[model samples]
Each structure stands twice: as C-alpha cells, then as structure tokens.
Target: MTDKAVSTIAELARDFGVTARTIRFYEAEGMISPERQGSQRLYHPRDRVRLKLILRGKRLGFSLAEIREIIDLYDSAPGERGQLDFFLDMIEKRRVDLEQKRRDIDLTLSELAEVERNCRNRLSELAKGREQA
Candidate 1:
C-alpha cells in the first residue's frame, strides 16, 4: 500500500490528538478497523477518516451507538438523499434534547441562587443578633 494510503496506529493517534488506547478502544468498539501486520496495527485512510468522525461525534455529545449508526450509513448509503434526511432528523432530536437540558440547568441555577441568598441573609441576621446581645 502507498504511504499516503496507510498509517501506523501511533501516527494516527498523534495526528488526531488521541491516545493509542483510545484508538484501540475505538477499534474494539468497531468504530474503526485497522489491518493487522503481525502484532502491529496499520490504519488505512478510511480508518483514519472514521476515527476523525468518531472523535467529532463524541465532541458533539453523541453516544457511541448513535455515532456507529451514522458511520454505518457512510458505507450503506453513500451519496444518498435518504442519508441526509436521516442525519437531519438525528440532528433535530439532539438539538431538542440539548435545549431541554439547558432549560433544566437554568432553572437549577436560579434555585441555587435563591437558596444562597436566603442563607446569606440568615447569616447576617444572626450576626446582628449577636452584636445586639
């Protein structure tokens, strides 16, 4: 294979800012499939691209199962409009979930602020009582 078409596991890990163990984990999860050269693993360009996509999917908070579904489509439906539609649907679902999480967080933070304010007010009252006593 041409050098441009193949890469070592270390090379891919370094290039992608990931650990060798992370690559191995992805390989184990079937997210990437590197060819075995004796005890060494040689990654093809396709594997490299899949690793990049896997990392991107993780960064976007997608579960491995979801990432696997999307990655599987690359081979199963290359250049198909159906794939685009499916991907768009997934994106909308993710967006709705994330927005709901954001709203929940906002409410939690507001409640925390009110609790903190009450605690501080109580502390000030106690301090004033002690001073007056």
Candidate 2:
C-alpha cells in the first residue's frame, strides 16, 4: 500500500535466488531503486516487483537494455498499453530467434550424426581388412 520497506536486499536476494551483488547491479543499472537508509538498502514493493521482472526477463534471454525499456514503459505516459505492446513484440522476436536457433541446432546434430556414422563404417571396414589379412 505504501512505499515502505517491504523487504531488505538480503531478503530479496534470498527470495529471488540471486546474489546481493546482482541486486545491487540492477540498482546501479537504474532498473530498480530501493530506498537507501545509510548503509542498508530497503526494498519496497515496487522495487521487489521490478526485480522480479528483471530476473524473469534475464531468464527469457532479454538483454538489460531491452528489459529496461519494458520497465521504463511500465512507468511512462503510455503505461500498460505501451508496456504490453512492447512486450508482445519482444516475445514474437524472441520466439523467432529461438526457432532459428532450434533449426541450427537440429542441423548441427544431423551433421554430427552423419559424421559419427561415417566414422563407425570406416572403423568397420578397417577391421574387416585386418581380419582378411
């Protein structure tokens, strides 16, 4: 309800399964701004939510710049519509990129399998020639 201390940096790191330094890095990157009280940093609900979004975006392979755009859009004049539209576009782009990666990986695996089969057949032929000798 208020911008009070909902969690400390350590608490957020423990809950989010990230290191304190990582949270600090986000703070430094202007992604999330926690309230600073002398030596201790207190995270409010907004900070917590933003941290969650940052982690999720990272897991989804989003760059820090892309994630920042989404987070900034959430607070800008366009609000949720801009945020949602941008996120949708990002999702589509990510999908296409991942699909291409998948195809490349599949092609690499097929080539590897072919190489392995050739290697085994060469080994078999060598063994047969030795036995005939």
lDDT per residue (tens digit) for residues 1-133 in model 2: 2344578887888888989999999999989898889999989888988988999999999999999999999889789999999999999999999999999999999999999999999999999999999
Please list the Cα RMSD from the true structure of every candidate, rounded to 1 decimal place.
Answer: 2.7, 2.5
Give the CA lDDT, 0 to 100, for residue 72 in model 2.
96
**Candidate 2 versus the native: TM-score?**
0.95
lDDT agreement with native, every candidate: 0.87, 0.92
Q: In model 2, which regions exceed 4 Å deviation?
A: 1-5
TM-score of 1: 0.89
Cα deviation at 95, candidate 1, in Å, is 1.4
Name the runs in model 1 displaced over 4 angstroms: 1-3, 78-80
Candidate 1: tens digits of C-alpha lDDT, residues 85-131: 77688889999999999999999999999999999999999999999
Q: What is candidate 1's local distance difference test score?
A: 0.87
lDDT of 2 at 54: 93
